[model samples]
Every structure is written in structure tokens, then in C-alpha cells.
Target: MESMLFASIKPMLATVGDEPFDDEDFLFEPKWDGARMLLHKQGERIEAYTRSGRRVTDKFPELKEAALAIIAEQAVLDCEGVCMNGGRAVFDDFAYRLRLGDSRRIAAAARSHPASWIAFDVLATTREHLREPLHDRKRIVNECIEPSERLSPCAFLMGRGKALYDWTKEHRLEGIVAKRRYSGYQAGVVSADWIKVKHPVEIDAIILGYRMLPVFAFVIGLHFRTVRFKPVGLVEAGISAEQRAAFLGIVAGGLHAKQEGTTQWLKPALCCRIEYRDRSDWHELSGTTFKGFLPDKRVDDCMWTY
Candidate 1:
């Protein structure tokens, strides 16, 4: 059967919430640390993209099995591309996978470090379901995709976000996400209808610049107002000397870096995650520490918005 056209899509985003709360109108699920992906399948052809609309279909070729898992004529799935390590979802493993450029190496890594697409919502099947309530679309998700090792549905809990949040904390998972059961999907929008409560509230920041002199730190910033990179704070902890040397090597290998006084500024091309207590009003990350480099993420994806 020929595949019908689905509308251009972007993953819906979640607003940051202060804390987890139990409510009858919401459903909670794990806020996976894996890359946010949207898988589009048509007949035997499958394509995948990151949240910033970067095509990554070839990067994770194992995910092409979504075409087999999806029983619908055509489908659009909002999912997370997770890399597994020792039976646990490891973001670093997936980041390493994204760093590979050779197709043969990527294929080899697929077997060595297997990954899966964890579907959370279905936006289309035989027809578009953007207007359908989230709870209603859960049934459609079940109908559209058969759960398999390559692709599986994300299980959710109703009216117990705090419990799931506790579980994630105890297990050292990212956090828990709560979505309004009656809310419809809004592409590319960050709405309060879907809320994310993180364990320590991590933020993705652009590597605006770096200073290697007295402190050996990374100058992290966000693209708020978005005219230019807004300096937030320095990421001095959690990044080892080995990581620092590797990052500087990339800069030396013509990734574009220029000296600005004592700091070396680069073009907007690199990003890193930061674990912080809160975002200050003056655009600073309070009690900040380096989390990890984001290889699958776009530079502009590190925005200051909620």
C-alpha cells in the first residue's frame, strides 16, 4: 500500500513544573534522558527526526524496524530514541552512538550498543489525531504499533506523579513527566498542558565560549531573546581533564574558535547539559555543574524558555 502524506511535524514540548503533583486529570510517565524523536512510517519506509527537526533516520538504523512494528498505512509517532547499556537506559551510550559518522561503524554499534524507539504518543495513523485528546490517542497508539524489542509503547501512570517521581529518583532516572489527559497535541509548542518535574532540574546550555586559564571552565549560555548567545554561568565541575582535552581538540581541529580577551569564543555549534538548582533572574544557573555533552542536539535547542 502506498503511504499518504502526513503534515510537517515537530515534537510537542513540556513546561517545567516546580514539583510533582497528583491529579486525576493527568497521566505521568518517565522523562527519559534519551533523545526526543519523531518516527514517521509509510509502508516499509521509515524516517526519524530529532526534536529540532534534524533527520536522524540513518544514525539509528535499528529504529527502521518501526515500519514493521507499525501496522497502520502511515503513522507519526512521538518517541524517545534510547540506547541501552547493561539493561538500563544510558544517555551517554546514545550520545556516543550519535557521534559516529561512518555508516558501517554505526551499524556495528547497533549490535554492540542496541537502541530502541520508545513511543509515547501517536500523532497520526490512517488520519491525523492532533485534535484528539491524549487519553483517546493512547488507544490509537496501541492499535497503530505492535510492541516489540525494537519499538515499544511507553507505559504511563494515572493520578500518581509523585510516586513515579520517587521511583525515578530512587533508581537515578532522569525524572517524571505529567501530561493532561484531555489535552490535544500541539506541534513545536511548549505548553503547560504537559509538565516536566525533574529530580534536580537540568537545563541544556550552549557552549557559548570557554576559558582555560585560571579555572579551566566552560562558559555556558542559552539562546533567549535569541539575537546572540546569552551568557548564563560557568560549568566547572563534573567535566574531567580527559573530556576537557577532547573538547579543546575539537576546537583546534577547525571547529572555529577565536580568542576574546582571556576567553575563547566559538560559533553556536556545541551544546552541553547542566544540572542546577534553579535559573536565576539575571540569567545565571545557580549551583551549576556539568552534566554531559549533547551530541544529538542542535545548538539552538538549548533555549532559555520553560
Candidate 2:
């Protein structure tokens, strides 16, 4: 069997928005909290790539095998490679498995924290389906892919987005994504045709310092427009080592002060999105987790919310 000619394409991105009303023109799907991957299969050969076009075929052998199991002559699928634990997608476990370079460790991780591909769109079959409407592409994906333990179609709810969002919140799922039924796939673009509404309390915070001990942690501060910055809390979750290194590099040379037994303070020029529960009366964030660095956001944009 020959391998498919793979093309590096950025998957379509979703815009953040409030949950929308249930409308017949849209379909809603659960937003899996995992790495975005594109799967390509031809005959008995299969390959996978990250949303950034990084080739990760060998990183997930089980998913590759699952892709090969797909019933198709040639195909390209937009999927999320999720590591589910107790019926919930765990991003940290999925990221850890994706970073394992050793075969033995990878095998062990696969046995312990196996990943699955939740296919959301069919970009191509024997022919390209890029210009097809979302509803048509969704139908094609449902018909072409053979379901297995490691692979399954992403289920969608039609004109019931509010109910789905309520269910997602009640079940502690990541969020709900709504896509316009008539919108065509547009690679590498953050389009309004699709919107994502998360179930967490999200806020923008300013970077203050970081700790390198026991484990890596980022100390962030809260700001209210022109108000002074105040230490809110520290977050040691949801960020990968690679992301930590990248963040350190971004804050390099911006150091302002350092406490011998505490943190290395920065200039507070960087902003990041944090997901957490309500802030305590003492102004400390509860159940905080690093979401991602917000490059487009500025320090002045960070606002404190109680």
C-alpha cells in the first residue's frame, strides 16, 4: 500500500464567544481539551500532524493504526488526539504522552493513558472536500470513518446549543463549539463561522514571577485597567515544560527584582489567560490553571474580577 501525499495545512480555529441561542442554522460539539491533530490515511499507510504542521506520526502509534483502520481509499481528517481519564479529556496526560521520545516510555504511556482520535471533519476522500459546506463534510466523515476503540466520530447536536452548553457545564467538560452549518472549511483562519464557549471562569492576568523549585510555577498579578497590580496567586498547572521554556525566554531580561527564598519578579509586561474558580475574599485565585499566553493582550488589558 502506498502512502498518501500529505499537505501541511493549518486546521480551522474557533473564535471565543458567549454561548449562543439554539438556532437551526448551527451545530454544536463538545470541545475536547487535547492536542489538535490532522490525520491522513491511504490504503494501509497513515500519518498524523499537529495543528502547527509538526509531524507526529510516530508519537502516537495507536492513533496511526486507528487511522489505517479507517475505511477509505485516500482521506484526510481533522481530529483532536485526546487522552481521556474517567470519561474526561486530560490535557496534561495527553501532552506528556506526546512529549515522550523513548519507545519504551511511549509504549508504557499508551498502555496507561491511551489516546483516541475524535474526528470532527473530513477534509478529503478520494477527492478534496475543502469547499464543501460543514454539514456536507460532517456527513462525509460520519459515513467514511469506521468506528473503533481508538477512533470515533465527534457527535454533534443540532439547534440545541444552549442545552448542550448546560450539559457541558454540568458534566465539567471543557466547553462547547458551535459551527455554522453552511460555512465551508477555511484552513489556518480564526473564523466567526465557528464559536467556542468555555465552562470555566476565564480572566486575563499579568505575569509577575516564576518558581523553578519542586516544579515550575508562574506567579501572576491582577490588574484593573489603570489600577495598580496586586499579587493574586501562583499557578503550577496546565503548562507544559516546552511552554514554560518559551515563556521564560519571552520574559528574559525583563527581570526587576528577586527574593532569595521566593520568586524572581519580572517587569509585568506579559499577559496570559487563566481559568479558575471564583477569587477568594483575600483576592487569591482559586483552582487556577494556565490556559495560554495571550500575545495580542497587553498588561493594561489585564482586569481584576472578583
Candidate 3:
């Protein structure tokens, strides 16, 4: 039979309350700091698929080798390939490998910073497509992928709304994702079956100030409000001449540094998005920036949390 193709999408749930897992409701898993992929193995052949459904077996030879080495006769998996160094995920390091397309860099990356698989779902383990309820799929995944250094099961905190929320915050995990225990797997976008909660809301703020460095142009700050134009935090800006030029291009007539009252300030016109770890003390930022600016969003609508 031709290899089956599984949808690369899965529902990501939001946190409700910090509720504890009761025996009947839901299962939880660890959120991996890695790229998501679909793993397929049949006989001696193995392959990986990107989120866009592109075949990426050749791009991750190490992972392909792991799949082939599995003693299972045939299987399909939903997993993430995280490149870890000293127990921390290094997205930049993996990105560098992506930029270097040749086999040499691929081999070098494998040796210097290898990728580990975090198996979360089992699409197929026996000959049938387990399009059954998500709860069952998770159970089979746990049974199939044993805990090893290279392969570990994702742990989740399943419970009532408030308890799970508390656990998520206490653990400093991304946030608790609440899922309806009976939902079936749906291919495409995020399903209503799941929900997520992140602390320290993210927001879009205006660029208000910056600190210039010899290595870069400026560490940009953002404004929390336009009418009041309150200074929030700074984003590491102007990393390169080209970056400085780009930033200048984005902001009208570049930048001019001066002081406003007792505060050192830059023009509050440029906008940026930033994510924070918490919002308990949103009112004050004694000696810090608004958090970190996210380049993927607009300045006018910087994400914010209450």
C-alpha cells in the first residue's frame, strides 16, 4: 500500500483554570522547543514531513536513522525535533543548520548539536489509521514510545480548570492547554476542542527609547500607550548595519536620541510586539524593558497581557 499522509496540524488548547487532572477527563504532555514533524516508518524505510507537508527525510538524516532503527514493524508518529544544548533549546543554532544546506553542515550539526524526538501522538501503529478519539491516540503513543534519553513521552497536567492553571504557572511551562476529552482528531486548523493560556500577556508597543552599542545601532524601547506615550521596554535592536538601515527605513527619518524630563528617550513613533512572562506587576518596570519585542507582529498592535 502507498504510504499514508497525515495532516500536519493539531489542536492547541488554551488554559482554563488551575485545575488538577481527575482520572476521567484529559491527558497532558510536555510542550517541546522544537520543530513539528510527521514521522513514518515502513519495514526498513523511514521518512519525515514538515508542517507544510513537504518531505523532509533527507533534511533530518539523524532522525530518519532513529525511525529505521525502531524495532516496531511499522508506525506513524506526530512529534517535535528539538535541538538541545545543555538542557536548553537553541532555536538559533538549529536555524544556522537550516541556512547551511550542504551535507557537510548537516553532519556537523548532528555532531555539535543533535536533535531529539519528543513523540506526542501516534497516528498509526498497527495497520489502521487511528483517527479515533485523541485520548486513545495519546494512550497508544505512551505505550509505543518508551522513555529513553532520545525518546521521552510528553507529560501533561490534566485536572480541573483552576488547578491546571496553577500547575502551569508554577512549572513555568508555556501554559496549560485544555482539551475536551472526547474530541476526535481533525485535520486543518486549530480545533475548538483545545485551549491555551499564557501568563505575562504579550502586546504591541511603540518604540520610545534605545541604547546604542558599538556592535549594534540601538536597543529599541516600546510605548505602552500613545496618548500618554508611556515607555515600556526595549527590544534588542540594530544588530547589524543592514539591520540598522532597515530599522531606519521602517521609522521615518531614522532615530534621534534625546532626554524627556528625567528619562532618556528616543522618538516614540516606531512600534513593536513583545511577550512577557507574567502580568502581576504590569504597572511597574523599574529596571527593565517591556519584555521582548516580537518581530513577526506590528508595532501598533504589540501583544499585551493583563
Model 1, position 124, has a per-residue lDDT of 79
lDDT of 3 at 268: 53
What tens digits encode model 2's per-residue C-alpha lDDT throughout 1-306?
Answer: 123258778999988775456889999999887889988888787888888898888777796669655887778999999988878887767877778999898888888989899999988888878798999999999887888889889999998999998888777677889999999999899999999877767888988888888878888888753457888898898999889988878777555566657677877778888987534334677678999999889787687642
Model 3 segments beyond 4 Å from truth? 1-24, 160-173, 199-306
lDDT comparing candidate 3 with the true structure: 0.55
Work out the TM-score per prediction.
Answer: 0.68, 0.69, 0.59
Candidate with best lDDT: 2
Alpha-carbon shift of residue 234 in model 1 (angstroms): 3.7
Score residue 7 of candidate 3 by CA lDDT: 33
Candidate 1 structure quality by residue, lDDT tens digits, 1-306: 123243346789998886899999999998776788888887787888777777777888786665788888788899998886655577756766777889999989999888898899988787778899999998888888888889988989999999999998887677889999999999889999999887776788889788977888888888765345888888888899888998999877776667888798887788989888444335577667898899888986788643
* Cα lDDT computed for each candidate against the true fold: 0.82, 0.82, 0.55
True-vs-predicted CA distance for residue 44, candidate 1, Å? 0.9
TM-score of 1: 0.68
- Report model 3's TM-score to 2 decimal places: 0.59
